[model samples]
Target: MSYRLPARPRARFSYTRWQQRFAPYLFVSPFFILFLVFALFPLLFSLYLAFHLWSPLDGLGNWKFVGFENFALALGAQDLFWQTLKNTVWIGLLAGVPQHLVALPLAFVIHQSLRRYQSTLSTILFLPYITNAVAIAIVFATLYSERLGLLNYARGAFGLDPVRWLGDPGMVPYSVAAVVFWRYLGWNVVLYLSGLQAISEDVYEAATVDGAGRWQQFWYITLPLLRPMMFYAFTLTIVGNMQLFEEPFMLLNDGGGSGGAGLTTAMHIFNTAFRDLDLGYASAMSWLLFLAIFALSMVNNLLFSRGGER
Candidate 1:
């Protein structure tokens, strides 16, 4: 008779081995857990709230389902939403257009000529962007003050009338836009500078060898290469400006100053949600604003992509 082969031993499961296998997931689980609790939950709840008429004072689970009435009201001619949206777009254009116009050239100048002092200059330019918005707004409010303000004092010294920077409805939008422009101009410059730095020096050198002038090289090469950064910066500007609230809110107060001239869509939404306690309508308006921002961003992307292809 042939000898029987030895039976193989079964491997038993070890708790330590299992722990080691899942250790990384265990370590990362807290972040996902927190996101689910805070961020994701609030977002889902807001969408739910958009369809129901519920006030915080009314207690939870007492909301009346209103279907699409909230959205319809916001979009209808009877609401201030359209006017506030118009104000937002106007101020956005006023602030955003000049930012790119100035930043691109300023960045080009800094990149080409100020290499030795780039870091120092960049830091100085970036100060406004990093400064507290509330503090900046407070200071600007003083500057925009009609009587005792520095701007008006200068006007007096020049034998000109003291302008109503914040009082006149016609001037409110411009005043608010000025603050937005000053705060974000430096940030755009920094973005453009980074874009300029990433460009290859050889391309410029080759252009120089080909007898292309500085203006020509910049127009043909730099601009084409900088398209991606321009798109990114433009997208940020669109989103930020559309949701503009801080400067106007701080300068003009919750009522939006005289004629509600400086009231942006964001400010309007805030007033609706908190002041009037119409959370549902405010939520609908917020989602609509989100859609508008998304559409503008898509248009920006499309333009840049087309430019890149050409």
Candidate 2:
């Protein structure tokens, strides 16, 4: 009786408390909801579809379960899949390796020698990264033309023959890779520049007091400190270049242009899904490509970790 009804249980939560606890989630719910519908659900559905055979014409729920048939066919001795895979890897290397090599040195020079012009230089460099891929690809397609292109014009000025930038099978990958390089190079430069900026000037000052010359300071101090950033940049380049699609697609067109030299794995999967209407096969190919990317990432991780430990 003295308990006096135990204070009526306080309604478990006051209105203000409920609002404070859940208001943030309420605000963020739209993103999660849209992600579930657009990304997660589709990803799950694609995984399901990877094991089944169905065309858009057959409608949903009419899929025939085919186990790993889709995967088998993709990984089989089919020249298209393997050839495209080779092209993807080759272009990835062509674009990615030079990107870091150039970006690192460029960022270092700008950071050390051109501090006054850093902002202007960064803005100029970053423009390509933000430019619309399709628009730039169209411009580059013209520049890459076998004749009457600016690049050919430049070559003519140098008394060299016009190079087939996108025409020849051997040249097509390089052409696509160059466009990829131009677009992503600035991104890596910005990343390296940020990492360079984060480094303490006091450390450099101390090195200077220790009689470290510019090259010595850069070699011993800057390079070691920049290892983390280098790893991060390398990883990004690996992931992006491995999955490259748009520039090659737009510049080379749907069939990946002459001899399918510019045909990436993404383009192949796209053709399988939309053109052939083989959603299952496309999903399987996508997963395989994903695995390839994952493996390479792991290899990169291993290399970085080993270097760090050493």
**What do the candidate models score in CA lDDT, each in turn?**
0.92, 0.90
RMSD of each candidate? Answer: 3.0, 2.7
1-310: candidate 2 lDDT, tens digit per residue: 4655555555665789989999889999999999999999999999999999999999879999999998899989954788889999999999999998899889989999999999999999999999999899889988988787999999999999998888888899889999999998999999999999999999999999989988898889888899889888988888888788899899988788888999999999999999999999999998999899899988888887864462
Off by over 4 Å in 2: 1-14, 307-310
**Tens digits of per-residue lDDT for model 1, 201-280:** 99999999999998998899999999889989999999999999988998999888889999999999999999999898
**Model 1: CA > 4 A from native:** 1-16, 307-310
Per candidate, the number of residue pairs that clash is: 0, 0
Please give the range of 10 consecutive residues that has the lowest summed lDDT in model 1: 301-310
TM-score of each: 0.93, 0.93
